[model samples]
Target: MRIVLDGISRQMVDRKVKAGQVLAVPGPSGRRIYPTFQFAADGSLLPGLPAVLAALPTRDPWAVLNFLVNPDARLGGRTAVDLLRDGRVDEVVRAARHLDDQGA
Candidate 1:
């Protein structure tokens, strides 16, 4: 992941995760594993990802991943990540904001 980030320091990555500016899921070995999907090919975060992350109902990384990958009715049966990849960030964020109301 560091290589993908172009050699960004661990501390910097940690800070980003802590700030809710990046997503890092826990691996089997208890290491935080950063998902590549959240980043563009150039290694920057997908646009508006930070806002979506912030709007998520849960801070749990696993829940966050599930929310992003699962199809949501609010998003017209598309996954949040899919909408994000398509640059429909406002729609994703809107869904995320209402996730808790739907008992997600």
Candidate 2:
């Protein structure tokens, strides 16, 4: 499956996305194609990326940060997807934001 993200969602991705612009997927098998460069690629959508943050449990601006960086600190390729599926994304973001706010 493929998705196109835009608007505030686009900003969210831009803030945390890598140069490759890899969208967080459901599993490791989900291919991460660069939508900005290739519009019609297998496992990718058209125009732009999908609004993943919009689908989150809350509208916290920090959630996108947590999602993108959370996987950076983990070895498991599917860690980010797991966080989303389990509904712990918001909690993780909140905790991360709190830590950041406290300078910890």
TM-score of predicted model 2?
Answer: 0.26
Q: 1-104 in candidate 1: lDDT tens per residue?
A: 35365457779888999999899998887988998888877777888889999998799998899889899989988899999989899999999888889454
Using TM-score as the measure, the top candidate is 1
Candidate 2 per-residue C-alpha lDDT over 37-83 given as tens digits, one digit per residue, 9 for 90 to 100: 22343324322223343333433334543543455343243343444
Runs in model 1 lying further than 4 Å from the true structure: 1-3
Clashing pairs in 2: 4-49, 4-50, 5-49, 5-50
Task: List CA RMSD, all candidates.
Answer: 1.8, 11.3
Q: Give candidate 2 regions above 4 Å deviation.
A: 1-3, 6-67, 71-81
Error of 1 at 53 (Å): 0.5
The true-versus-predicted C-alpha distance at residue 73 of model 1, in Å, is 0.6
| lDDT scores of the candidates, listed in order | 0.87, 0.40
Q: Work out candidate 2's RMSD over C-alphas.
A: 11.3
Clashes of 1: 0
